[model samples]
Structures are given as structure tokens and as C-alpha cells.
Target chain A: MSSRLLSRAPQDTPGTWKSYLGLGVILLVSAFPVYWMFVIATSSDEAVMSSPPALIPGDQLMVNLREVFTMQDVFFTASLINSLIVSLAVTASTLFFCSLAGFAFAKLRFKGHNVLMFIVILTLTVPNQLGVVALFIVMGELGWNGTLLAVIAPGLVTAFGVFYMRQFIGHAIPDELVEAARIDGALTMRIYWTVVVPAIRPALAVLGLLTFVATWNDFQWPLITLNGTDYPTSMVALSDLASGNYVVYRRVLAGAFVATVPLVVLLLVGGRQLVRGIMEGALK
Target chain B: MALTDVRHARTEEPRHAPPKRQRFWLHRFDTKTFPYLMIAPFFLLFAVFGLFPLIFNAVVSLRHWHLIDKEKNGWVGLDNFTKLASDTDFWDALVNTFGIFVLSTVPQLLLALMIANLLNRKLRGATFWRIGILLPYVTPVAASSLVFAVFFSRDNGLANWFLSLVGFGQEQPLDWRAGTWSSWIAIAVMVNWKWIGYNALLYLSAMQAIPKDVYEAAAVDGAGPWRQLWQITVPMIQPVVLFTVILSTIGGLQLFTEPMLFDENPAQANGGYDHQWRTIAQLIYRVGWSDLNLGYAAAMSWALFLIILVVAGINALVTRRLGGGK
Candidate 1:
């Protein structure tokens, strides 16, 4: 990791014009669909469907936005609230439980640690969706069907989350620091809450961002569990809107833009952190 | 040294006369119990929600279980598997999955490598460009599918609209999501659009981790950028490329939301009117949920799981070869 700092762009030569042109094209293709979505969202219903498609934003933004906000069948407003609540709940539980378990696995000496850690890592290869059939039945038995808890509980602590947290805590806190706490007569939980948690805030922040975004953007399970609900999630609601009308491109685009707004805002706020987190995650 | 040895030996010896200590069960301070308790939630949940269901699915797949009617359930043994072997829809879905996986993943990886190579250059606003490219990834699948569906539509769609504007292919309109190839191509576009930049960023990061000194030394030896890329960069990032390929394999096989939502008829998770794009994941859903054939659906899931495992094994073998056969 220090190689970056050590070298500091060792080949920081001037870029040629070809590089800029190529980058410009890449950027255009990357961002154009999003820009086009914005345009269609604000375009008149007729202009949106017209041949050659509206190249620029039209003046229907206020109307379509209002329609999306008020659309009952699509349940945009209610779904947004549901998404926020469920995502926050899942994120909170994941952060707390994954970190606690990570601290124990990384720092504490205990029986079955190696075996348990192996199991955890092995579980990473088994996609959770593989167990969805059983999970569905379990939820039904627990009477968690059609509830947010179905979504929240299953995702509360993921194997990858544990692995990630363990990696982070392993690198961040040294054994000597932990031993010092032990000699100071601090209980395990006390030491964890005070010294360990504060020391690993950056890693935690990355995990928290990833967890929240993933939970927010999750679909299939939510679609299965929260199906037929007036309020499932904004993503599901967008799908609902898309499928609801025959050719309501304006309203659909409007809802899509709304669904994407939070994520875009999140990017603008913590894009660098997200990129770093993803990089760190990829390395692991 | 003598004094320290004596002290260590004295401490090593068990003390017979002990102070008052807490009880094992009631006090609960011994044997690192806290650590066990802390890690228990994940295991417990995985057991109940993950492992149990997986095992149950295995058992249930062999039985003639129906969702609505309990009396119809009976031991069917390997009937489900045998039936799936002869099932044309299953094969078609599998073919479609593989077709799309290859179609999208190949170009995506190549383009990603090219983009990574470019991004490795000294460019201004590199961060902005990188983040901007990843925007499609952050967009919810359902939302992006809607936009892509609109773009790929036959009538009033962007492709045909542009074709007409350019005075080309006006006679035969671009029906982007009708035929087998067309539907796969359209879905591939969406998949590639969502993933290419993310993959590029990954490659870029891997490239960044590669020391520039190697490139400079290669340059001193008169290697050009193109030569350096194929010889140095590609080989260095082969592991990442392999990782993404395997990951994309797993993901592409499970392709659901885009194909599910892209069709005009949302009910047709079967891909299209002709079932040209129904993925294995969607097949599982159609069999289990729509057909109410729980046993068959479970069987399909197991089948899909086995295929993924086989592919993963192949991936491991390939990885070994990549590591110089060590």
C-alpha cells in the first residue's frame, strides 16, 4: 500500500491529447444514459416518445416530479419511507454485530476459532441466494413474511461482513494494545467499546457505507417478500411504475431519477471513500 | 538471568493455596465465553436462515412437494433431476445464460483493460472520471433496466431513432429485444453498461498497484506502451481478470432483474415472447413460484448450484495454471 506513497506517480508525465479525447468519449458514454434519463424525466410525454428522442431536458420536470410524488399505485412516497427505514435498520445491525464478532475473532483467543473462521470464509463462496428457498420457508414459519424484518434479519450479519471487519481490525489494532487493556483490568466488551471501536472508525465507515447502499439497492428478495405491498422500497416502486403503465415513459423516468437521487447524493458526498472501500475490499 | 529464571519457574508452578474465585456457571468469567457469545449471532443465524434451508432444499428437491397442496407431497427420489435433464426449457435457459455471459463478459473485460490502461496515464480529474464511470453501477438494477428498456424498444426507441437520423437501416428497424440474438445482445448491453466501468476501476487499481519503475525499465529497454501493456500490465493483473471472470460467471448465470424487467410484459420473467432470455435464476422462480412445483424448483436451484460449483472448480484449476503451475 505504501508503494503508492513511495512512488507518488513515478511516471507522472504529461498526457497526450489522444488520452483526453478517449477519456471524453468514455465519460460521455458513461454519463449519457443518466443525463438522458434526466432529460426524459423532464421532457413532455409526447417529446419523450418522439423519434430521435429529446436531446435536452424539457420543461415537464415540475409536473412529472409532482406526479411521481403523488402516485398511489406506484407508491413512490410510501416506498421511499420503507426503503429508508429498512436500509437504516439493516445497516445498523450489520455494523454492530459484524464489528463485535470481528473483534473477537481477530483479537480474542478462544476454542474453535480457527474452525469457525474457516467456516465463515467458506460460507463466503456460498451465495446467500442459494439458500433463498429455505430462507423463504423459514421466514414463513417465523411469520416474518411480508415484513421488513424478513429483509433486515437475514442481512443483519453477513459472512463477508465478518471477514471484512476481521481484516480491518487485524490491521488496525495491535496485540500489545489489547494486552495493555487487559492488564488495566478492562473487561473485553469495555475495551472493545472504548479503544477498539474508536481505532477502527475508517474501516467501520467503509463497511457502513457499503452495507447501507447494498441494503438500499437490494431488489429480488424485497420483491419476493414485500410483493403486493403498497410500500416495498423505492427500487421496487420504480419497477412497479415501469410495469404499471403501457407507455408512461415520463413518469417512469421521473420515478427512476428519484430512486437514483439518494445514491447520486451519496456518491457526491463520499465518492472517494466508496472508491477506497471498494479497492480495499477488492484487495481482500 | 538467574533471578528471572527463578521468577518464571516460580510463576510456572501451580499455586496450591488459591484466593476466592467466581463460580464457573454463575459468574461466567472463565474460558473466553464472551468471545463465543460475540461471534454466536452470525453462526446462529447462518445455521437457521442459511444452512438449514439449504439442507432442507436438498431434501425437499427429491420429494414431490407442491406449494398449495400438502397431500400431493411424496418421495420422488431422483425423478426431479431426471426430468430436468430432459427439460428443454431448462436447457434453453442454460444456453441463454451462457450466451449472455460470454457476450457481455468478453467485451466488458477487454474494454475494462483498455480503459484501465488509459486511466493509468497522467490525466486531470481522474477521480471525477473514475467516479462518474461507476454511476451506472450505483443505479438500482430495476431503474437502469427501465431506462435501457426504453432505449432498446422497437418503436420510439433511441437506436432506431438514431438509425433513421443517420439515414441508415431505415427499412429494417432495430428490434433490439425480439429474437434470441437480439434479446441477448440487448441484455448484454445493459449488463456491460452497468459493470464495465466498475471492472475498469478494479483493473485500474490493480494497475496502480503495479510499480512504475518496471514500466520505466521496460521503456529504457525500448519497450513501447503497447508492448509494456500486454507484457507487463496484463500479466500483472491476470489474477484480477480471472477473479472478475469467475465472479461474472456466477453473476451472469443468476441474471434475473434486467431480463425480468426489460420485457414489455413484466410477467414474462421467461425473457421474451419466445423465452429467449429467461435465465436459470428466473427458471427457478418460474418453476417454483409460478408453476407451484416446489420440488422441481428446489431441484433446479440445486442443479444451478452444482453447475456454479463445477465452474468454480474449473476456475481454481485455471488459477493454478495462472500461478505458474505451482
Candidate 2:
């Protein structure tokens, strides 16, 4: 047994070496673009456009930031405020509505309950892009053409959110507890507020994180609806900055980095829950 | 206990007035009402935003009208549909959309599966590795696509630098935003880079759920890792593979942001040079926003919607067959 154990150690070392080498390769490939973004962000326009590119950080980050801020009213402050307000409003509304619907679907018995659930699930198959043109007209008609409401209104009740919450509530809350509250003559809203809310706290946290990240990172609809006239999301502003003819590489990179930071931080904080939520939502 | 008591009283004391009275009060009272009330906001919001807009879109698609002249939106029975059927530009956009979808999605899923398999092995700092893989997916689309646009630029681009090293340098940096195939390749790379990790993570999660004993038994039977993977892992995760494939197809058909951003140059508004990269979504945007042909844009949207539904349906059927399940 001792001889076998000694032999295994020699064999295992090469395998371990290979595994570490593979891991190193993956880490480099995955991180290089992000590293490159920062490197460019700090470099001057000339350094960025230089022949071999600046592999290291340069001294123009602050200057580039100043340019980005002064170049447009859309970038540094207004867009940031717009993004924050839209994301916060959307997240809060989604949480309130989705949890309520989720609770009903999970625990409540009502007329057309099964049918309603099926319809909700069916909507998942319809891509929101399909309704873009008509929705644009609707927005125009409603006088929400350049407002943040145009961006936030359509995304308020995500079908995925409802589905996710229902699954979470089904497993996390018990019917017996709710029934007990009901027997004591608690109002329907009272039981939900006092009992069900406490039980599903973790699910709410997960949903909130997911919803916030999604709203924060959303691009296409905002691109269409908010056209950078009155207020634009961070993404739309960044797109305009990059797409313009007077290409200042450092400022563009700076904008990109700023846009990416919030999402990276959020993902780091909620990575595990996010992964578990996605897996549960997809597989189940 | 209370529910059971209420049920017992209702059944046993139907003829007795006192028990009936108590049971009636119990039956009418409960907290279920609250759950329903709490849940109403989602339905209310969905009715206004989700369902109404969808129904309204379908209605608008059938009418002949411009946004500026709403009074002219008279009911035109299937005229929009018929016009789309005969429009060559519509067909071209449809072809371009599917072309790019196939070019990107096929290789993306294949590469993702391979990467997920590699990552599934026992490795050091597995959490770090997993997060690194997902970095691209999490990067904001606008920002990453901008980076890609710069990378694919004609002059002094990194892609050309590497290509020249590999002996493909004789041609001018391939005019990525210009020709049909070049623009498609650029779009495909952006789509693949952004999504491959997402699909990989999904595949990895499914793979982890697979039992270890099956792989152990295969190894005991003198099977190599590749053979075990092919025989055991692939079959076990076939359902997930189908799911991603269908999801990717739906996503691919929509193909808006990359093409829109990549073709942002005013000169290339008709897609790249000769309208090579113009997709259905771009066409819809161009008609509605740029040209102010809202009626034509609505028509195009309906046409694209039908195409998406059909493609998704076909994808579902094919995957189900390949998955070998009822």
C-alpha cells in the first residue's frame, strides 16, 4: 500500500501541472479585453492609436475623463442620473408586482389560476423585439417619446420574473402557515405582509439583484426609445460617444470602463445567487 | 388543522344549523385573498404594457397608415402582408438575418460545449475560472461591441495585425464593415464572444448534475475521457443542449444590436457596402426612424415576427427529434 501511494504522487504531479496551465490560459484569455479596456482608458488618443498599442497604463486618464464630461451634457451627469432613476424605478416596481403575482400563483387558489399561469408562461416565447415598431407608435401617441418612462414602462412586468418568483415561493413558503393566519381572521394582504414576506426574503434579494442588473445593462430598447434627446441611459450615451466621427479613443474607453464598473461590482456581490437563479430558471 | 375542521364541519353538519353557520364563516375567511391582491400589480402592469402593446402591434401591422398621418390608418386587409411578400428588400433582410444567425450560433454552441467540458474537470481556482469565462457575457453590450468595432477597423487593427502574422496580410484589413462576408464575420465574432460563455455556464451547470458513477463505470470499462464524454456526458445533457439551441435561435433571429452598431456609419446605413449586413431589424429601424415610413416599418415587423415564429417552431421540432424524446 505504501509503494502504491508513493507511485501515485509521481503520476499526479504532471496532471496537476497540466490543469494549472489550462487554468492560466483561460484566465488570461478572459481577462485580456478588460485589462486592455483599462489600459486604453488611461492612455492618450495618440498612445491609443499608436502602432503596437500601449500595453501599459499611461497618464491621460484624468484628462480623458475631463474631455468626456465636457464634450456632452449626455455623458457624465445627466445620463448617469437618468440610468439610476430608470433602473431603480423598474427594479422596485418589478419586485413589488412580481412577488405579488408569484405569491398568488404559488399559494392562492383562484378562478382561472391555471389558465393565467399558462398564459404567463406562453408569453416567454414571444420576443419583445417583435412589438418594437408598434410600441414606438404607441409611445409617440402617449407623449412619452423621449422620456425615461418609455424605457421603463415596457419592462415592468417581466414574465421571467414572475416565473422565477413563483418557483421560489413554491418551495420557500408553506400553505399551512398562511392558512393558520387566515383562520385567525387575518386579511389576505395582512397575511402576505406579515407572514409570506418574511419567508421569501432570500428570493426577493435574488430577484432584485437580477432585475437591477438587467435594467442597468439593457441597450436595444433604450437605444430605440430614448434617442439621447432629453435623457439617455448610460448605454445609449456610450454608443453615441463611440459611434461619432471625432473618435477620441481614451474618452471612449473611459466611458466604456465607467459603464462596466457598476455591473462588475453587482455581479461580484451577487454572483452565486445569480448563477443559482439562472440555473433554476432555465433547467426547471 | 383549522382547514380540516372546517371541511369536517361542512360535511358532517349540513343538516345542523349551528355547524353550518360556523362552516360558512370559516369558508369565506382566509388569507388567500391577500396573495391574489398582492399579485394583481403584475397582471395590471402586464395588461397595459405587455398584452396591450402586443395586441396593438398586431392591429397596426394590418393597417395602412403613417405616424404623421394617423387618420389615414384605414383597415387594409392583409395589404401589408402582401406587400412584404413581394418586397425584395424584405426578402434580402430576412436572408441576411438567418445567414448571420447560422454563421454565429453553430460555432458558438460547439465551442461553448467544448469549453464547458474542459472546465468541468477538477481544476485549481475553479470559481475564478468560472467567473473569468463569464466576464465577456456580463460586459455591457454597447461597450464590448465598441471594442470589437475598433478591433475590426481597417487600419492598424489588432485583427489585421494577427492575420498578417499568419500570412493573410496581403489584402487590405478585409474591410470588415464593407463586404457581405466580411461584415457577417465581424458580426458573428461579436455575437459569439458575447454569448459563448453564457451558453458554457449553462452547459456546465447541467453537466455537474450528472452522476459521477456513470463516468467511473465507463473508466473502469477501459473508456478514455473522450469516449466517456461522448457516450455519457453528451447524452445526459442533451436536453440542455436542445434548450440552448432553441434559445439561441430565437435570440439569433432578433439580431439587432450588433448589426445596428456595426453598421452605424452613415454611408453604411444600408448595412455595409452594397447593403451586405442589413438585417430585418435594421430594415425596420431604417424605415421607421430614418425614412419615416411607419406603415412600411409595421409591415416589415409583422413579416419578421412570422418568420421568427416559424424558425423557432422548426428549431423546437428538430431539437426534439435530435434529443430523441417524446
Candidate 3:
């Protein structure tokens, strides 16, 4: 399929030029808002509000950064740490639990397996937002309201992750290997840890990266669960900064830029893998 | 059949072999326990966080309780739900939510499909274009909404500047945050900008999954690219199209941050300019956090959940019919 796609590359001709032009226009329209973000981020506040509006970069970026730090104290450093810890914790825990369950559902002989799998799939449509009000009360009762754990706790056992990993492992891992390991007297956990894990490494990598990115970008749950008193994730901090009544536009932009840089870097570094994962997700 | 055979073999030799039977039972126990052990964490976590909260929220919805006045809590039965049913603000917010959902999701999906088709063509710099499109999806929502706020400002903003360039210069800049329709438009634009690319990329992936032989065969039959796209690619990716539609309905209905932040008065939980942009999620937050009416907020959340469930169900039914009744 890929080879055919590659071989069908249109030669440079008037027809090809017309296709390219059409695509170029589409790309420009799709990408303009993001470009305008960086443009305004670098422009002065006055220039941003000018009659014509600044299309060119201004020289107030440093000043804006300074103001953002002084005014919001977004605790940019702390927020970054908080985001990192929460995302990593969610990713690691999800990978561990999801893969274990996925392996069991795929390779193990267990009673009620079909029923359990059905239940997991059924929960997929139940959006997490439905439980937020109750979740808040639970957190309040547990005295975990202001902690990063509150944000990470509900996300750790995503039904999507388990279902996705099950499909991946079922398709990617061979039944013969598990049978061979069993015949060789390898324990179930040992076989899973050593054999299944290595075989499904690619799927695990995709799921892990996706979980990290989603957790990092999450807003609603964190907004409800994490009070601003202590550990503020970057999204929460950015929301507070933007909503501040006395906020300066440029500094807010700077803070926005600061918040966005890590994601950009991650995407650039893992673009191929991320794209492949998203594609696979959509296809499924 | 295999289980019966194994059971018959086990029972046949069990009269004089208690130790062997004990070992067999232990092996069976190990086999059964392994899967349970492996899958326990998810059930455990869900019980604590997902299931318990859901049931508790139902209970909370039955009471008349404010967060600040815990001792004054009283059994309200169905009063909160009845009150919300009659509330004008809730109805207005519900209307605005659906309005924005239609305005944003329909165009966003269409544009996404078109762009995906464009990207699917044999072109240079396809990788760059694909990554560039994903930029908006990855950008922080708060940041993107703030950027939109600046760009859509009534005075001295880029959108107004462009409008002026097109001979609306003498008129006043459009007050995007003022009335219901204008606020909905701004909210739609923000949503469309953020999500269109993500959907486009999703469509692109689905397009890529189509076997090239089908398209080639269509081409051989004298079909143009446009005709081939409609007759082949669209039908093949219909499942993906359904997926995106349902997913967007879910996300779009719960939208809060962009409108909440873009409201003229950010500090106020009430969406600005006569509550023009108030969405159900925002209203839930306002009732719970701002107004301190926890019971009412819980009821609103459940109401919103029911709305999502119904919308999602309708979407599923429509998509199933559209997907050739599969």
C-alpha cells in the first residue's frame, strides 16, 4: 500500500502545479491562526492593539517575559515540574496496568473474560465529565483536593488504553509464543513481562506517548480537582494567568509561548511516531 | 468440548489420587487468579474514582445543599432537576451549546475532509504540511483562546482590520462578545481553528489506509480524481467519518474553556454580555464553584450527561444508517 502511494507521485506538470496550488492555499488557511499566535506573541501590546495591527515582530518580547514572571509568578518552573510529574505518572501507571490487563485478555484463559472485556468497552462512551461533580466530593473527602494526584488519579485506568492495547497486542503478538512459554514452565507473569512486553513494544510506545500528551494538555479535570494553592499544572496556571483581570497582553502571550514550547519540541522530536499513533487510533 | 474432556480426564483418576487432584486444583487456581490479579488495578481504581463518584453524584443531585452550608442540607427530591428544567439561563445555555456545536463541528469536519484529501494527493513537502496542520491541536487551549481574544478584539484587532480592508471601514468593529449570535460565531471560530487540523489529520490517516489498487482500478475505469474520491474514498472511510462525528459531538457539547475565557468579563463565571456564550459545562461550574450551589450543580451535570447520551445515541443511529446500515 505504501509502495503504491509512493509510486503514484504526480510529476511536475501544469496539472500537478494546480494541485499543489490548491493544497498550498488550504495549508495557509489552516495554519494562519497558529502563525498569528507567534506573530502577536512577539509584538508589543500597543502594536497588537494598533489600528493596522502589527504583522511584523516587535522588540518587546523580553519585557513581556519579565512582566509575565513578575505579575503572574506562574511559577513557570514549578508548573513545568508539576506537568511533568503528573503526565509521567499517568503514562507509567497506565502502561503497566493496561498492558497487563491487555495481555491477560488477549492470551490468558480466564472465566468471565468476555464479560469483563465487554464491560470495559461499554465504559468507553461514558465521558469522564459525567463524574466530575462526584469526583470533586470524593477528593474533598479524601483531603486530596489540592494535590496533583487528584488530577492524575482518575486518568490512570483509562478504558480506552486497555481496549487499544488489547487490540494491539492481539494483532501483534503470536499465540504460539505464549503456548511455547507455558510448555517451557514459564509462569504467566514471567511470560508477559519478558515475552509479550518486547513483542508489543511499538504499541506500548505509541500508547505511552499518547497518554503523556493527553495528560499534559488536559484542562477540565485539573481545573476542577487541583486547587491553585500548591501544585499547579501548566494548563491550570495558563488559565489563571489569562483570566487575571490585570493581565498584560504581551506577558500573557509570553506565558502562552512558554507553555507551548515543550509540546512543540515533543511533537517535532516524535512527529513520525505521534502521527502513526494518531492514524492508527483514527482507523480503529 | 475441550473443557468437558479435561474435566472427564481429571475425574476419572481422582478416586485414589488426592495429591494429583490437589495439584490440578492448584493449577486451575493459578490460571484463574492470574488474570484477576493482572486486571484488578483498573477495577480498584475505577471503584474509587469512577464508579463511586458517579453514584455519589446521583445522591448529591437529590439534595438541596450549598458547599458553604453543609449543615443546612435537606432532601430536595426532584426539585433541583425541576428548577433547572424551568430555568431560562439553562435553556439559553443549552441552545447556545448546540448552536456553537453545529456552527463549529459541521464546517470543521468538512474543511478537515477537504484538507485531508488535498494532503492525500501526491505532493512535495507533505510531511511538513501534515505536521504544520497538527500545530493548533497541540497548542494549549488557554493560549490559543487568548490569541483568539486578541485577534477578535472589536477595536484594533486583526479580524476587524481585515474587515475594514474589505470596505467595512466606516462601520464600527463587530462586537463579538455582545450578543448571542456574535459570541457564538467567535466561539465557533476558536473551536474550528483548534480542532479542524486534528480532524484533518485523522481523515488523512483513514485516507492513507485505503488500498491503492481500488483507486487505480477506478482510474482505469475512466474516473477522475474527484469522482474517485467521492465514489471510493468517502465510502471506505465512512466508519472513520462516523467516529469523528460522534467524538466531536461529545467534545463540542462539553466545551467550556474557550468561551469561558473569551467572555468579556473573565472573572465572572456567568458568560459575558447577557450570558451570550454560556454553555452547560460553564453553567455547571458557575453553580458549583461560583454560586456555591453544589446540589443544583450536580443536577446540572447529570442533565448535561443525559443530553450528551441522547446526542451521542442519535449520532450513532444516524451514522449507522449512513454507513449502509451496518
Candidate 4:
């Protein structure tokens, strides 16, 4: 490892300008649409509708935002809060449930453990959206239609989260540690709470961040469950604004831009962890 | 403060379970009941939400379920499937779904591969580059698609504006959402934009995990960058490639939000007015929600599920053959 580090150090030589230019162009294209979104959000209707549309940002961001908030009976603030609530609740429940289940699978083995674990892994292969037909009908039957719970309940703990946590717990914590905890008269649940949770916190963090981002961006199920209702969610509500018969393009863009700021901040904070979690979930 | 108090209390022996009968319950919990309880939520939830829906959907597909008399269930075995066979909308949606999938996934993966290679180097600002590539992945599909819808608007959208700047589509600003192929292209662009960075970073991380010694040894053997990339990088990343292929395959038929939101009608989930780009998912939503034909929608759902399974199964077979080793 030390020699590997030394050799990797020599690779720290200044990168050629070609590499920079290549990456620069890629990043620009990758990020330009988002920038264009900002440009539209802050521009006037005449400006947005101008021939050879404006590339530069304009100063009507607050004005358009005001228009967006004022147009709909659905307040933009309620949508934001609803989105945060759903994402955070799903994240919290998924982390706790998946980690607990993963620890049980990894450390505290019981009867039918392998079979249950196999089922968990197998379910990962099945497409999740296939259940939507029944889920929506059942949601209506249960009077959960247009409610966030209809969306949240099914997604509270995912198979992928369980698989991810199991992998992390299996590798991170040694059997001796679990055995030591048990011998210390720590009950099984107690050992998991004290030992497994802290030991697998990094994986927990990764799973939590990924789940939050995924739930935040999940459009279809929420779109279905919350469809044709005035119930609040950022994405569904945004689509409502977008598809309105006589939507103000610039104003709707402003609402979209406003809704994206939190996610942009999340990307800044959780970006690297998100990448690692995905790779580790796949390869590790 | 309250959490710490609870933790402190948990460390002490439980005075609540003082009776011998209660002690047995605690022992059972610590031994046999604990693990099952730990994982029960998943199984319980899956049985209710996952397995039950799948099974119920199969049954729902067989019945004549309509909204007019929602509670009335008339047995119509294989009738729904027969309708699906002749359903032009189903076929059109099927073609569009695969078309969008191929257009989006192929280019997305190829570009992602190239971008991953560029990002694989031990370069400065690696974090920044990773974040840049990842920015789109984090953006909500609704917001991004809404932005793209605006960008691809009939006349005044920015896409046409830029294209016209290059003297293309100058005489007439292309109405993106009206045409069949053009609408497919527009939706494909949005899908690719959202996923390319995500796939690239994943591929990048997987590439970084490739042993450094392999590249060094190949370099010493006079293998140039391109040669080494083909000879080593591609072969080594085969599993990850396979993984991405499977993921993309599964994600393909589930394509809903981007096209659903990118449509000209804005809120139209059933593709567009003529159903030009109506994907299988949108078709299912249309049948169940708009037409209020639960049986037909359920039938379509199962059919879509079958398509996914068959396509994924075939791909997995080819991938396994090419992958030689796990």
C-alpha cells in the first residue's frame, strides 16, 4: 500500500492542457442546461421568447418566483416542505430498517436466514414499478390515493438498501466483535444498536444520502399517487405548473429553479459519497 | 439529550422484566425471536406491497374491471390479453419505448465510457470534475424535464434558437413535440442528460478500482494509451458494463417521467395528442387512469413485465457468455 501510494504520487504531475480542455467542454455541456434553466427563470417573457434566446441570466428571478407562487392554489412553500418531509422520512426509515435487517443477516443468524437473504437479493432483480398497477388501485381502495403515505409506505425499505447494508455490515464488522458484544451480556438487539449501527454508519450515511436523492427525484409513483389532486409535492406540483394550459414559461422555470437549489446543495455535500456508494454497491 | 438518556438507561438491566415469566420472554427475544423481528418489516411490507400487488395485478388483468361499476368484477379470462395482441397503441408504445431506450442507453453508455476514461486519470480537481458530472444526476426529473420542455418548445425555445444560430432549422423553428421521431429525440436527450453523468461516475469509480499495476505493466510493454484502453480497460470493466446494461435494460421500460413531462401538452402522461411517443409505461397509465379500464391496464402491466423479463434474460445470457468469468 505504501509503495502504491508512492507511485501514485508521481502521477500527480501537472495535467496537460488538453485534458483540462476536454474535461472543461464535457462539464460545460453537462451543466449548461441547468444554467439555461437559470437563464429562463430570471428572464422576462419577451426576453425568453426572443429570437436566439438569451444565454445570459436576467434579473426577473424574484418577479417570476412571485408569479409562480401567486398563480397556483398550491403554495410553492408547501410543495418544498412536502418534498423534504417525504424524502427525509423515507431516508430515516430506510436507514433504520435496512441497517437492522442487514445486521441481522450479517451477524445474528437464525433459522431461514439464508433463504430470507436470497429472497431479498432476488427481489432486487425484479423491476419495482411493475407493482404500480395494483399499488395505485389498492391505494385508492385504502383511501391512500393522493396521500404521500401511498408513496412512502411501499418505499420505506428497499431491497437495494438491504443488500447495500448487508454488504457493508458483512465486510466492516468482524465476527469477533459481534461475539464480544454478545459475551458482554449485550442482548442481540442491544449489540446491533450499539455496535452495528456505529460500525456501519459510513454505509448508513451512503445509503441515507442515496435514498434521499432518489426519493427526492422520484417522479412517477408520486405523479401517479398524487395525480389529479391538489396534494403537494415538488415534482408533481412542478409538472402541474409545466403542463398548465396557459403556463408562463419563465415563471414556471423560476419555480423549477427554486426547487432545485436544495438538491444542488445536496450534490455539493453528498456528491462524492453518492459516487462511492453506487460503485461500492455494484462492485464491492 | 433525550437520546443519550435512553442509551444510558438501556445499559442498565431491565427492572420491568422482573418476573420469571417475563424473563423467559426476554430470553426468547434475545435468542430466537430477535432476528426475525429485525427483518420482519421487509418481508411484511413486501408481502403486502410488492408480492401482493404483482399477484393482484395478474388477477386484475383477467377481470372486466371498469370505472363505471368499479366494484363489479366480471371474469374475462384471456380477453384482456387478446385485446393487448391487437392493440395498436400497445405496439406503438412498445416501439417507442425500445427506440428511446436504445437511443438513450447506447449513446449514454458510450459517452459515459469515454467520460469515465477521461475522469480516470489522477488529475487535479478530481472532486470538482466528479461533482460536475454528477450534477445532472441529482437534479429532479420533473424540474429538468420541465426545463427541457421549455428548451424544446415549438418556436421560441432555446434549442431551436441555438440550432438556428448554426444555420440549421433556421427557416422554420422545429416543433419538437409534434413530430414522431423528433419527439423521440427530444425525450431521449433529456433521459441521456440525466443519466450520462451518473453512469460515467459509476464507470469511473469502477475503472479506478482496476489494478494500477495492469496499466503500468502494459505501458512498459509498449502499449499506447489507446491500445491499453482497448486491451485492458474495456476487458476489465466487462462486469461493470454488464451491470450497467442490466440496469439500463430494467430502467428502459420504466421510462415515465421524462417523456411524460417533456410532452407538448405538459401534463399529458399518455404520450402526446396522437400518442406519437407514448411509452409502455404511459400506455399503462393511460389505460388504467384515463380510460379507467383496470383490467386492460393490468393486462398491459403484466405484458410489460414479461417484456422486461424476456429482454433482460436474453441480455444476461449474452453478457454471461462474453464475461467468461464472474
Q: What does DockQ give for each predicted structure? A: 0.44, 0.38, 0.43, 0.51
Candidate topping TM-score: 4
lDDT of 4 at B109: 88
DockQ of 3: 0.43
CAPRI class assigned to model 1: acceptable
Clashing pairs in 3: none
Better of 1 and 4 by lDDT: 4
The prediction achieving the highest DockQ against the true structure is 4
Kindly give the stretch of ten consecutive residues in candidate 4 chain B with the minimal lDDT sum.
Answer: B8-17
lDDT per residue as tens, model 4, A26-109: 899888888888999999988988877888999998898888888656556777888888999999999999999998898886
On TM-score, the stronger of 2 and 3 is: 3
What would you estimate as the lDDT of candidate 4? 0.83
TM-score of 1: 0.91
lDDT per residue, candidate 1, A1-284, as tens digits?
A: 33333233323644679887888898898887888889999999789877778889999999999988887777788888899999899888888999999998999989889999999998877766766676777888898878888888888898988999999999999999988877655678888998899998888888888888888888887877776776578877777777643658888889888888888888888777777787677677
lDDT of 1 at A130: 67
lDDT of model number 3: 0.80
lDDT: which candidate is best?
4
Candidate 3's residue-wise lDDT over A1-284, tens digit each? 44343334222112367667876776686567656766677778678778798877777777777766665446666787899999999999999999999988888978899999998888787777877888888999988898987888888878888988888888988899988887654678889888999988888888887888788888877877664565788877777777655666676677778778887887787767777788888877
Ranking by TM-score: 4, 1, 3, 2
Task: Give the Cα-based TM-score of candidate 2 against the true structure.
Answer: 0.88
Worst 10 residues of 3 chain A by lDDT: A6-15
Clashing pairs in 4: none
